[model samples]
Target: MYFTIRPARPADVHGILTADIAAGRTSPADAERFAAGISAAVADPARLVVVAEAHDDANAEGGTGVVGWAKTHHWDYADGPAPAGHYLGGVTVRPEFRRKGLAAQLTEARLHWMWERVEFAWYVVNAHNEASLALHRRWGFREVARGARFHTVAFDGGEGVLLSAARPQA
Candidate 1:
């Protein structure tokens, strides 16, 4: 359960990809496309890909491995005209690591990154995901709008709420 949060590296792509697929967030066929996208993000200085790496006592190399990950980047809302801002996307923690506050740690890291670059942070969550909704609200995000804004998209087919939170002042 001991882990450290750090910026993701190119080598962590497979661990991230495996976690995403295991979480049912993406399919196996999407591996190639996801790898390319992840590679680009890792290389982009403006973007961030953070991962929670757990210490591996069983490994002889004495190195840690990624167990959770979250990324921040610009997302253009296509439903209607809206200001583009930093989007908190792809937040995930492995199943065994759930309820251990890894998600919050990942989110806090993303928010900290946001406060340095933007006035606001945007994210979309499935309406039925009460846990995620509660987490966002607890972190000060308020729903700006909901319904078909994310249509034809992943997970819930665009049936979700659009939420935003002001960047915390330093």
Candidate 2:
């Protein structure tokens, strides 16, 4: 199968959200909010959002459609004074598209984008998500920290980890 990867555009937000929801990684409302955030991120060159497109069949116009996405944020690692690093999150792939190497491609591209500006790239994965943990490991992302209050939404809280992959020196 052929894959086309590229930096996501503001107009791709809805398609991205749809893919995320289809993967069962996020709710409709959460995906909507994330879509808006993605648009804003795209407007800022510092933020990186990448997508992978795969063709459903041969001889199709556009050839492939969006199958997955990865987002990296240029934000502070800590609320207090400290050197800030790129935080990558919000990775999602359609259920039908899983295990097809799309996520890894998107990840590598996003990390490359991050390497251009930051010293390190980090990501948070829910502790219960063994699949994500394994994927991160396979990509050379090491665990940097662990915590219970890793993320909070409304009344929901979950355990997660901070993982980082070394970026090639320019």
Identify the runs in model 1 with alpha carbons over 4 angstroms from their true place: 56-63, 76-81, 150-158
Give the alpha-carbon lDDT of every model. 0.79, 0.74
Per-model clash counts, in order, read 2, 0
Q: Using alpha carbons, what is the TM-score of model 1?
A: 0.85
Question: Worst lDDT window (10 residues) for model 2?
Answer: 147-156
Q: State TM-scores per candidate.
A: 0.85, 0.82
Tens digits of per-residue lDDT for model 1 on 1-170?
36788899998999888888877787999999988998899888878999888765676354456788999877554555224667788588888777888899898898888878888887887888888888888678988877765533344464677788987666
Q: Pick by TM-score: which candidate is best?
A: 1
**CA shift at 140, candidate 2, in angstroms?**
2.7
Tell me how candidate 2 scores on lDDT.
0.74
Model 2 collision count: 0
